[model samples]
Target: MSHSAIRRVPASVQSLRSRAVWLLLALVLAVAADAPSAASQAQAPATADDLKQVQQMIDKGHTDEALKRLDELAVTQPVVPGVHRLQGQAYYAANRFSDADSAFAAALVQDPHDLESTQMRGLTLFRMGKPAEAIPLLTAAHNWGPQTRVDPSYVLALCYLDTRRYDDARHSFALQYGFPPDSASSYLLAARMLFRRDFVPVAKDFAEKALALDPQLPLVHQLLGEIALAGNHLDEAIAEFEKERARNPLDGAVYDRLGDAYSRAGNYQPALESLQRAVLLEPYNSAPYILLGKVLLRQQVPANAAMYLEHAVGMDPGNYMAHSLLGQAYRSLGRTSDASRETQTAEKLQADTEPKLQNVK
Candidate 1:
């Protein structure tokens, strides 16, 4: 974190407005109220109490005032210990990553062995999209063995993935979750982890490795089918899903996926058969009933579609898609008022859930 390396990170406050932020603020207060560490004790006794008060202000969502007090304290005691680290924590809480980096760097200069500073600096660099710079510090922090509940291993894995170091990511993830580094489950875990980040080709390769290691592995074929379906390779998806059905005959989700592929390929007859089987296999699941209703609507059987959709809506009142599709069915059946009511309900639900859906953090 040299002067030249301290660039402002483009972070959005809205993206990080979850309960995690609240917990972190609370953590600041909790840690500051604890007995002072060696760093805090190196300063005058008054300075230590003052720093604790600053942390209280930050915990109460007063970064601006907390920072002002820290500046005053630094002016009074030019060589005060742990001041820079407290400043970094305040900046981080305020979403000021560039300032946080500089403060954390200064703390490290005074005490290079500060594990908390190392971890915070690594996280700040990561938020600035400097994963290459963050890796060494995070690796060091990882070796410190859970100093706090917040694990740096997950961020390290993301760094490895972002840099396309698939092998490193696999090892890191295995270490994080206590899996054997070369085990089949580790490869599968890595594959799904990559898939979640939209690295589909690498995910497919790892999934292939998982399958090779254990031919009887469950969900491997289903994962393959999902990748194929995402790419609109309907024939491949259907084939892979059929193989998964063979491996997991009692899995209703496989039948539902199979029905979705058939419907996408305009094979409504096969779609109806698969969906019916899914419904029978999962009698209480609203998902199969919804898919069945969709297939029926596509087949121009509005009465049957409405019946299944009504049952699905009854089971999951908050499902916007079911409400929307039920609205369409009602419209087809000339039930104008019922269609209008369902449409309004669906729109309201969609609007209410949009913020949650867009919350990447």
Candidate 2:
């Protein structure tokens, strides 16, 4: 998926708490401990035997036991350079984020230039919903050198994305992927990053380069479709989405985009079919439901529109567009009180978001 597609929190749903939830989920999937092995701890001036033992326990997947041993060592050797670092690794492996964060912090105090501790601490802070604190540590780790294993650059890119540092995120992701500019994947990734930053013209240039390099690249057509949609070139968007569908028929996001394009092009029947397919493919996503409601309303099927809009609102109550559309549907169905309530809610949401929208530029 494109970074723009993933990171584009709906304007109506732009709350830090909500964005943090999504970011934390991404961090959990991406971040890993940059733990050094026993033989690789040459620079550490700590008790080598204890470090070696901790690494053995971690390697054997006995994280709990490793934590217990680290705790024992900490009571006697609290200022040991690598001790807390190893403890952080064990705690991270055990999914104890708070403990891991503190351990990493302690390790950094003892040895400020410890790259593994720095990266692990940054990753821990990110997982703990502290992206601002993670940024400097991650940047330092990234600047240190190439990571042999468990690169922290991806997590760092995500931190930049979460913090709305678009240019930094783009650079970090490019570094993480390490693809030459001529590579199709590199072009596509650059396109997605630029798209997220609202640099649509530049994004289109990169997308075109990706297409020129490999027309059959998995998401290149989808990126083009998104660009076309952004420009309100409905027919062009539909054509690109159709090409994507031909290549990846089972992708729910493609169906959702195609359905949206069809609806905008006044092809209601096809829009309904495409959206229904999207719902079947990814039932949890609310976009298809919202689009289905919209198409139904356009088709003068207010009753059906109300049903789908209700589902959309149920799934994502913060979606102001869905609320507004549902209000229209309810008014058409002669549900005056319900329509009034939904309309008022939508208006309030729009008013609340107006300031943020104005500040976007």
Candidate 3:
């Protein structure tokens, strides 16, 4: 990060909190003597030794053994919050998100204010594809430590990013570090926000930084490709998107970027191929279909274009671009009545939106 970049305390504090959680857990074990057993030998209370052993196993990359210890510890200390907390952390490290969620929930019920447990629970929820549930928990965890820290805020920012709350993500990221985010996440979100505001140079710079940090980052590649496309750097955009596809074969947006780049480069055949792949990857998303239609329309394949546009409208009735392009395709095919209807629909859809086309023609 550049020295001139804006730095804020909240984001820094959040990062510090995340580091402190691990350190505190270690200190908690070292300084705090093990409590006496709360059960018989068959079901003994978990001592600091149990937690330390689990931690050691985890450090050694023996997640299964650590989790097994957590299971035994749980049997003896079912009501002890740390038992569930350890299980949660173990499951999370293993990428067993659903199991981690259940473990975290059990821990939260016993120790509601346990910052580490709460943060882990939030991350587990995020990994479970429940960003909405993760956001508030992460926000609360961020407040557990001093405001000058950064880790908690970083977590909160990521939750916002996952939920597509770009403005909130930007604000959270801005709190700790300025313009270019220190992490790949902060850079990606900042780039998008800057792009949305038409700050092209600044956005491109951050996007490049994001890719430099984590070349496989999805949004970073997408945005960088977009900026390159805007500058008529079609080959550059294709290269960026190709790198993204290599990293994430299932990413629909990468194909969409490829399609856009190919189309602008006047490679209609390749454009169609890429957009078709995008739609195949994300059949429910209407944007790729609309773009596909536009490409076919440019090729003078009105019938094929109309079919895709109709599909796009079916997927997203409110999509003005789809409606407008469908109208154009209908007009090109001499389907006057259909053209008029689609044009009217498009007009209505555009009534409250800008960059408005008065007619499809």
Q: Give the number of the best model, judged by lDDT.
A: 1
Give a tens-digit lDDT track for model 2, residues 140-215.
Answer: 8975444324567778877876787755766677787787535788778978977877878878888888899988
Q: What does candidate 3's lDDT look like per residue over 1-361, in tens digits?
A: 7655656457888999999999999888765544333335657677887788887787677889898877777776455457887787778778888888998888888888778878877777876778889888888876545322237666676677667676677677776465443678777777886777667887788788878898766767777888888888889999877877887788888898899888888889988998999999998889889989999999999999999999999989998889899999999999999999999999998986767556521
Identify the candidate with maximal TM-score: 1
Which regions of candidate 1 deviate over 4 angstroms?
1-69, 76-82, 143-150, 250-252, 269-289, 307-320, 344-361
153-269: candidate 1 lDDT, tens digit per residue? 878888899888999999888888999999888898899899889999999999999999999888889889999999999999999999999999999889999999999999999
Each model's RMSD to truth, in Å?
Answer: 19.2, 25.2, 25.3
Model 3 ranges with Cα > 4 A deviation:
1-171, 174-181, 216-218, 355-361
Best first by TM-score, ranked: 1, 2, 3
Which candidate, 2 or 3, has the higher lDDT?
2
TM-score of each: 0.73, 0.56, 0.49
For model 1, what is the alpha-carbon lDDT of residue 148? 43
lDDT of each: 0.88, 0.85, 0.80
- Taking all chains together, the TM-score of candidate 1 against the true structure is 0.73
